[model samples]
Target: MELDFWQQRWHENQTGFHLSDVNPCLLKYWPLFGGEGLDENKPATVFVPLCGKSLDLIWLASQSYSVIGVECSEKAVDAFFSEQSLSVQKEKSENFNIYKSEQIKLFQGDFFQLSKHHLASVSAVYDRASLVALPEAMRRRYVKHLAAILPASVSILLVTLEYDQALMAGPPFSLSETEVEQLYGSDFEIELLCREDIIDEQARFKERGLRYMFERVFKISR
Candidate 1:
């Protein structure tokens, strides 16, 4: 998908993929970081790519980690702060605008264009939607750029959906477990944290002839 595709999705209010509640997988896995053995400390800086006003941002902030979310839609960013009732300060940079509060900063711009400098302080990544939002052609580029920009030791908490593509087209694309390994195995260790058939939970997918849909969660580290 291109930039306009997502911008238009938000503009038209066609965001069925946007979850109203914080994801359960995130809540379960987040505490593993900054615990006794993990390298990450409390008050870590977590990066969220393609983060479209996800309630998870506020949840992460509530846990004391500073959050930096990169979103292409200004409306989504504005809605995040407004809906959360947080005060924000806006500033323009060379490539994107920064919407900042004490614990959260949202970058309103292209995710691919952001460089290492923009992500230098990122201690961890929480990718709930960014990877699956792209088509197969773009997924490789996204993973490569993500590995290059972040520190080598960074860990990632990722969630993906897998289903038969012939049954339906997707913005929530079908990402197989094998593909996930091939994409990040070269540089990061991959651990499958959760995998469960969620087709019954997804009414739209059931309507689209998807007999089975698996929601997979992974813990990735270098």
Candidate 2:
């Protein structure tokens, strides 16, 4: 994703990609990571890439997980803390502006610049929209970089959309099942949790001239 594109989107308040509330799929399916049994005294950390002021961060923190999120937009970072009424402190790092509260720390910078040391404590990852948000060329680089940096034991909960690209241009791009396998298969064991035909439910996408759209959820383990 281009920095200028996202910066312009944030400046113009053109963030339809920003959900009004936590994603329903996350509410119903987060426990599939089997992280609930982890010791509460030493909470597991969940990394959310390309996170954009999502309410899911709040929900995950409430579940006793230390949450780490990376986002490029500073406005989105500010909006998250302000909207949630969480007082946050800002700190400087070599590559990112770190925002912190109780259990959530959002690194504001380019996602590709992140390294393994930055994610040393992560036990799991939740990709509610990251992978599907990128174009075809960037998606492969995104996955490869992720695989390179994450610990071998990390688990991921990924959500993706599948639709015909010919029907529309996308940042909410259509990612086929085969593409997902090709991207994550070699390094991780993938499990399909569920898939639902959602075109009828997505009035906005329907308006964009899409006739069919499917949402798929996968639990990926390394």
Candidate 3:
């Protein structure tokens, strides 16, 4: 998929992937990484790729972690700060429109254009919707860039979906367990944190002809 695909989605307000609340899996499994696991030299910062006005940013800051989010949609970035009732400080960089409020900063631009320098203080990642949003080819490219930019010892909390692909097309694609390992195993230590059948909870997927679907959460340490 291209950048315009998502920009259009936001423009048209076709955002079924956008969640209204902080994800339950995050609340349950985050403490497994523990507070001390982050780098002690400075405040811990979590890099949220393709972040789309997620309430998770606010939740992370409440727990004392600084947030660095990279999003392609200016609409999404603006909506996040507005809905959160935050007063933002804006600046222009070579590749991004950087917006800041308190401990949260969002760089609005293409994810591929983001570099190591932008994530220098990042000690962890929270990927609730990013990985599963792409096709196989782009997903590979995404992982390669991520591995090259991020430092070792950074922990990633990733959530993905699994289902029969022939049943439906996707922006929220189906990713099996093996594919998740293959994508990140070369760059990080992988652990299956939890897996659960969540098809019943998702009424839209059921309406789309899915027989069953599962959600998987992984802890990937770089």
TM-scores, all models, native as reference: 0.96, 0.95, 0.96
Query: Which candidate has the highest TM-score of all?
Result: 1
Query: How accurate locally is residue 110 in candidate 1, as Cα lDDT from 0 to 100?
Result: 93
Model 3: residues with Cα > 4 Å off, grouped in runs: 36-43
Cα RMSD (angstroms) for every candidate in the order listed: 1.3, 2.1, 1.9
Q: How accurate is candidate 3 locally (lDDT)?
A: 0.89
Q: What lDDT does candidate 1 reach at residue 32?
A: 70
What local distance difference test score does each model get? 0.91, 0.89, 0.89
Candidate numbers sorted by TM-score from highest down: 1, 3, 2
lDDT by residue (174-205, candidate 1, tens digit) is: 99999999999998999998999999988988
- The predicted structure with the larger TM-score, 1 or 2, is 1
**lDDT of candidate 1 at residue 104, scale 0 to 100:** 95
Query: What local lDDT score does residue 154 receive in model 3, on the 0 to 100 scale?
Result: 87
Better model by TM-score, 1 or 3? 1
